[model samples]
Target: MTAVEETQQAEAEDFLVDKAKAVEVEVPDAPEEIGRSDYYTAKEVSMHNKPSDVWVSFLGNVYDLTSVVSSQSRELESDGSSLVFPLIKCAGTDISHWFDETTGDIKKYVDPIKNMMTYYIPQGRFVHVPPAEPVSDWDNSFEVPWWKDATLKVGKLSASTRSLRVKNVLTGHEHLMEVPCEETVGQIRARYLEYNAHAASYTWKALKPNEEKELVFQNLDMTLNLQDNGIADDQPTFEALGISSDFHTPVIHLYYDDDLTVA
Candidate 1:
């Protein structure tokens, strides 16, 4: 268990250290008033995937690791300009699972930071990270496994890590995107509304070829649905979403729902 400070450059191998005596630093207490969250969609996080400007998320907290991966900073890189495998590959995305599987613990990322809330300064702009979301489920629901020793976790390519091609039939908008496998149709719809502000102009419907089913946001049965067509969320990723062609991705049709009330 090696204790590498956030200011200290880390080797791919430093992460491999795992002895109970390794990390001896003390993190400060949680803030007196850490306040509420300010969420950022996955699309927003994906925009910062460069060494000059790297950003990554875990569950929902976002962090700017640019200096950690850049040419500066304590020489974290071998040549002093590039980051190691997986970490570099995971820029601009949620690395919750990867960190979990790798060290079999998640604190390696947090422990290095000393204070969990330091990454959220002057929120809603350069960095939109929030204090860890309030727990509504389990106490550790959002946590990476706790380790007695700072074990470097083994990494796994998350199923949600695959960016698929999607098209909005109403606007003829197409994009390559990555969505969490754990997300429900309803969750996806909420995310869609974040950017497509004109959604009400044409009632947008979410669909997947695997189920050939159209999803209506207010329809709890439809929105809460998690599987359909010929695939489930965890396997054959893109295919599970019914997307089989790069030239022709699944289309999310939009049309006015007649039953919707309007003033």
Candidate 2:
């Protein structure tokens, strides 16, 4: 080959090398969450609607009031008051409207009859709320109100939600579940337990793209979420590219473990 040709070839090779380096430099790994706070979805909170496992969200926070509901129910029954029924009726739901956003306390209004401030309990009075009029039988001394109690708070309410497809290979059943973006696989499984009582008797796996760029059923870490396990949502990218996000929803496959366990 001519000297000029050889020089041009070397220059072309150098250009390709520089381009590859630039591509690598432009792309970066997603940042890892630090001191990650626990978050729960509204659907998750709704699962425990009953008094035995009641949960409620208020002021963007989730609270597990199962024990409180049980104890309060008994106390109200013994006192011959049905105030606790209102709490049970509103379980597993958001009660933010019942509280004052600015003060983070129960809502109050000026009573027309009494001409004074009093709780505006349209849903009827529940635990910790004092009677509108003082009575001889009313208890004057009580601990902090349940709404202000921090111990009942389980986690923050999730700001975003995502869809997940869970398939049971054994029963040939496919179920779509809406879950919090911050929840782990273990928590998702707990949600699935409602559908299939023996959800724990199955080994959970997901169909994710491998190094070969082919989708395959891979073992999943129950402790981590789909994104943490390298299965990114990429919904925004899909939308920007004129591709539907629903087309790329990940599917989780469940294989029976044959543990013979009953829920």
Candidate 3:
């Protein structure tokens, strides 16, 4: 090849190499998750572990909690101020295990902050993440960890899925009805009474599957929580009634009749 032609080819090759290098140096950002499938790997999440860019992996998701304590000053002397940073010490770490150790129902604490969170609303600070949709059902995915409070949801952590089912057995009926696990017996009975108007006046009885003996709907002794709900308007949950894990305990039987004799 001629020297001139060789020189031109070399320049073209160098140009291509520089372009490829530019693309290689670029860091791909995690997708913006707006309540859909935006996932991040654990290694990718670790990048933001520093205090200035704190992130947390929770419930199979990565959350950027940098915003939560960003404005806090260690020197400030607010009441119980010492506790603030400590609680969020897991800022850039996977807090799922810790969070689970703290509570089974995270929404109970998270939902309260939707309208207002005095702790994060510092003096003269207008920075606040807008509230997202509230989770109406217990089984809802809306309980996204990073979505709560000032934590900016960076991305979701991929994980396996889980589900639960509840069965409602009715008296004078031959079949059991499936219900959502989070539903209370009271909610199911009210619906049953609404549909079965004739049985409305009947006293209600909850029984174990295939067992003739009625399962006493004790006044609020059991719940899927750490604390007893204390005789909730309805009885304990079917899960709390020992119907959760065992199918052998099949059919949470519900009986309602104006007369015990009729039941």
What is the total number of backbone clashes in candidate 1? Answer: 11
lDDT per model, in order?
A: 0.43, 0.80, 0.43
In candidate 2, the residue pairs with backbone N, CA or C atoms under 3 Å apart (3 or more residues apart, or in different chains) clash, namely none
- CA lDDT of 176 in candidate 2? 91
Per residue, candidate 3 scores C-alpha lDDT tens digits across 1-263 of 99999999999999999999887744434322122125555555667766677777776667676655564434222243432354255555665543433443232223364664322322211122222434342223333433354346666664421121223344445433333333344444443443554433343333322345554453221222102222122223545776544344333333332243333
Task: Indicate which candidate wins on TM-score.
Answer: 2
Candidate 2: list runs displaced more than 4 Å: 1-37, 74-80, 166-177, 183-263
Rank order by TM-score, top first? 2, 1, 3
Encode model 2's per-residue lDDT on 44-142: one tens digit a residue.
788888868888999999988777777767555235767678878988899999999999999999998889999999998888888887766666465
The residue ranges of model 1 lying beyond 4 angstroms of the native Cα positions read 1-47, 50-52, 56-63, 66-158, 161-177, 200-222, 225-248, 258-263
TM-score of each: 0.35, 0.56, 0.28
Encode model 1's per-residue lDDT on 141-246: one tens digit a residue: 3232222212322222233432344455655776555555544444445555555644443443444333445443322232333444222344365567886535
Evaluated at residue 57, the lDDT of candidate 1 is 70
lDDT of 3 at 185: 40
